[model samples]
Target: MSQSTYTVQGMTCGHCVQSVTEEVGALSGVSHVEVDLPTGLVTITSDSDLSEADVRTAVTEAGYQLAS
Candidate 1:
């Protein structure tokens, strides 16, 4: 598996973590997730090729923005 980290903005609490985790983790190739609220870092584990664009889309769909 491979991993990637994304900075997600507009998350404030555990509910935000849950929301982003569920949305991102449900995508194909996603295997695991770690969200760090203080740093706005979301680490994702995937078993196959997954583009950063897809991750950004997932974050956006969950009502957040992926930091560039």
Candidate 2:
């Protein structure tokens, strides 16, 4: 499996974490998603490496943005 960590901005609560987790986890190859609220870190594990564009889209769909 491939794992990727991204820094997401605008996440401030459990609901934010849940939103990000749900959105990112919905990706086809994604196997797991973990969001650390305090640090705004999102870790994603998948069957293969996921494209940055896809991850960015998922984060946007969750109403957030990835740190640049």
Candidate that scores best on TM-score: 2
Once fitted onto the true fold, the runs of candidate 1 whose alpha carbons sit more than 4 angstroms away are none
lDDT of 2: 0.98
- Scored by lDDT, the top model is 2
Model 2, which residues run further than 4 Å from truth? none
Show the lowest summed lDDT stretch of 10 residues, model 2.
27-36
Tens-digit per-residue lDDT, 1-68, candidate 2: 99999999999999999999999999989999999999999999999999999999999999999999
After superposing all C-alphas onto the true structure, candidate 2 shows an RMSD in angstroms of 0.4
TM-score to true structure, per model: 0.95, 0.98
Clashes of each: 0, 0
Pairs of residues at least 3 apart in sequence or in different chains that clash in candidate 1? none
Native-to-model Cα distance after best TM-score fit, residue 47 in candidate 1, in Å: 0.2
lDDT of 2 at 48: 97
